[model samples]
Target: MNEQALSVREAIIGRRSVKNFNGQPVDLENINSILEDARWAPTHGLRNPWRFIVAANKEYIKFQDVLKEYGVPKWKELSEEELEKQMKKFRTPGAVVFVVVQEDARQKERLEDYAAASALIQNAMLLAWDQGIGTCWKTPPFIDNPKFREELGVKPGERIMSMLQFGYYDDIPKGRVRTPLEDVVTYYGIEENGEEK
Candidate 1:
């Protein structure tokens, strides 16, 4: 656990998606703690639609072989140097989490489930940041492949929503500016002529 505690606003504003990890193994206990708290995220109909498949510590090493197969296609043909360079992305992360969500038969329920899972992901990211851990939510095309789904043991009637990576980083990436509310929002029923626009 980190000695310092950040306020919710600080965690939301300061957190950055870290792509450069230091390769230190993230404790499974810590990841569990984050998820335990994060599971409180809002879910429609009180259905907690998300679950995770995690690979950490020694397991991550084994996962590397799987990554080579899917993450880097034709990896065997590449030179040692080239393969190492390509594998760096997979190697650096201390842990990998595959977020899975139920795919309800009804369209509305399916969309709601996805939304709930997204909220859960955001909650986990914020919690991780507060603990001095960084996270990245990824959705690579391979996640949808049947082979990859089998590798993760994702069952039918469910979807892999995110490939979340958790790790430590030496640098705090600078935050980018977001679009101002004035540009992205419009007040309802507000007009110069006092008519709805």
Candidate 2:
């Protein structure tokens, strides 16, 4: 499918988090194309802080190994069966993309960078959905671990934001219902003296 041809509304409504993948390999070109879309996300002060490290095919195995190695200290308490189950979850995805953001000392700048990276992630998810690729953006607890960060090559002034798993799936999951607009939205100007006009 020509993802560029998809309407923004369609992409927004159609995108769903897919947990079950068919073990199909996604092309590197397609992944790059999706990242290209994410690159255009709006940024404050044009900081453009989003950075990605993609692990796919053979590289994915190494990525899993690194995660496991760093994760062992935390999971050492788990039984052998539990550890195996936990490891199985990481094995299925066709690719794993580590989203990182450069730290800024100023609080405002740091928040802005995080917000921009979030927009980039949303754009990536929608773009991938347009091309029939499914994604799950996970911020596992280990992402913040100092050892895990060092193993993943996250720099001194950078932080891992998300771990996005992408692949093709055998089934398209159903979308969940959103809260009604009236319940969540408040019209400030439209109300007069605490009463609706």
Candidate 3:
């Protein structure tokens, strides 16, 4: 389906974290379109701090190798077969995007940058979903490790926010339950003492 055919509400409410991919290659053009949509996400002061490192096709092999090497410290206790099984999971996605954000020295600016990058990720995910693609955004501890970050080409001033796995999937996951709006929202502006009018 074309991205324009999907409404914002459908994209927001229907998208799910897809774990199983059909193992088909997604076109580079579609991937670029998703990133372009992400580029339009709002940012404070127009910092446009988001950066992406995409791994696809033959690059996925190198990505899997890096995952295996970096994951060693965290998975030291696992058997070799177990480690291989885990690493194999990385191969299922058609592509993986490492989302990075440039950090600012000022705390508020840094926070805003992070928030903007998060919005960018959401935009990309929804855009992909609109095009009949699936995505999973993850923040594995190993990706933040110094050595791993260096291997992944993450610069000194940039922070990895998410590893977005994109692919085509045969399954459409059922919607998960969300907290009710009444339980999470509160309306004020009534009387003194913060009581509703």
Candidate 4:
């Protein structure tokens, strides 16, 4: 590992999921370029099932409304505190990529194929990291709501794998929790008879 390449690797390793954003408007051209890089991710059978959605004026309004449906009745009512919390949704690079898994007939286990497609989100995340943008790949109340999927133009058999929240960060992101490579790596496996072959 050369020093420069190692440093870049470390930078990626140090990336974190940032929640608080400055509400700064990011450059759309930069976002588009990042998406361009993201498309390079390997997909099975070249389905390119992932799709992106940028939350603009009306989209942002609909986003909040959909989020309201996921919470308690009081949240739907939206008190001042509730309203305050929801306001953060508006604050971002002003773009969101609704990574969807389009229905594919090629595979019996389509869910696994969808999962493979969802892996592209990491490519998008890392690309954003390189572009001085912070991201939060949210898969919460957003994914569980089927109606939002339809509203977002998702097809019948398709599903929302994740909601990638992108933005420029005013605050520095915190560190991450990672398991050591030594503990996780498995170099070789023993035989079925428990003999080291």
Candidate 5:
């Protein structure tokens, strides 16, 4: 690769997930920039069904409480250490971006919208990375918790695709080794002798 391309590669490759955060607060401007860039991301039908729930205010606390009250097993039985751990989870970071998918038109349903929204989120992830911010795209425990979403005032027709969290480094996380592309991709071609070798 040329120097220009190499620099781009360096930025992309340097992006890492940071779970630990300091007391620094992420301003609304940067978060807005990330979301604004995300709006331009392509979608198949151009319905642009991606909506966001900004969980930066008291809403975050409300969501946390709802998650606890909803009885997630991990949160249900909390020793002092465990309770502290859970409380500290979101204490530091800047903002929690909930990527919610609005219901689809044409009866395609909301699932397709979520698929498209996930693409928008990738745009967001890269944007955050380019801006020297940390992110963790949480799902399952967070996404599947409807009670928590409701606390964030997510409307009835919406569901989560992913969450694009943003903050400065709590701790610089180590990047993991990615699997080689060759192992995951294949070219459809006949073997040398037309045998299945």
Candidate 6:
């Protein structure tokens, strides 16, 4: 844990999706600690259907070449400056974790696995936030690319759910106001007009 751990309410409310990141390297040890706690997320039938492929520190440099080949389209045509600008999104993040989940044949089990993995991702984000690390959950189209999947060694019946980027940031993005609770919530046994069932 970095510094003092925040309360659950504080963590949930304060966390934001950070898209802009400073190029400072994030320690792999810190990420490991965060995921250690995140693995506690609910898994239906104890099916811990999630796994991660992490690229951090020096490894991130080599990973960039892979991203350039697969993630950037028509890189062969772009000027050096144009390519640099386009690659900034991938270059800035200090580390990235490709979150992969098992694709069960059964619809119910598959859905359950995805749901559990979603929770695990959220857990990781919140845990990262508590450590003063900024993170973004990205689902870029390249994740599903057959060549890209092969590069990451995603086997048959496994799917990448997120490209979770983590790093330090210069500014905290402002949080958006959520839909009003009154508008989103409904009371059971009460009609829309306030009549009891």
- Write the residue-wise lDDT of candidate 6 on 150-177 in tens digits: 9999999999999999999999999989
- The CA lDDT at 112 in model 1 is 91
Clashing pairs for predicted structure model 1, backbone only: none
For residues 1-197, could you state the per-residue lDDT of candidate 4 as single tens digits?
A: 11132254865786777787776655656667777877887776676777776664445546665556653346647787877676566444456677777777767558666766666788777777776778888877757566767777887877777787777778776677689886676557765566787
> Per-residue lDDT tens digits of candidate 2, residues 1-197?
35375799998988899888887877777889899878899999899997999988778777777767765555678898888777766767788899999999999999999999999999999999888899999987889988778877899999898999999988999998999887788877677346767
Give per-model CA RMSD: 2.0, 2.7, 2.9, 4.7, 4.8, 1.3
Per-model TM-score, in order, reads: 0.94, 0.87, 0.89, 0.77, 0.76, 0.95
Where is model 5 more than 4 Å wrong at Cα?
Answer: 1-8, 57-82, 105-112, 190-197
Error of 3 at 134 (Å): 0.4
Clashing pairs in 3: none
- Supply candidate 4's per-residue lDDT for 44: 69
Residue 166 lDDT in model 1? 98
Misplaced by over 4 Å in model 4 are: 1-8, 56-73, 89-93, 105-112, 189-197
10 residues in a row with least lDDT, candidate 6: 1-10
Candidate 5 lDDT over 1-197, as tens digits, reads 11122244775687787778774667777787778877877776788887787765455555556545643457656897887676675666677787877776546645666667877787777777777778888775756666666767787777776766677884678989999996786556756455565
Sorted by TM-score (best first), the order is 6, 1, 3, 2, 4, 5
Clashes in model 5: which pairs? 21-170
Best by lDDT: 6
Top of the candidates by TM-score:
6
| Cα lDDT computed for each candidate against the true fold | 0.92, 0.85, 0.85, 0.69, 0.70, 0.93
Considering summed lDDT, which 10 consecutive residues are worst modelled in model 3? 185-194
Over 4 Å off, model 2: 1-5, 71-84, 192-197
What's the C-alpha lDDT at position 185 in model 3? 67
Candidate with better lDDT, 3 vs 4 = 3
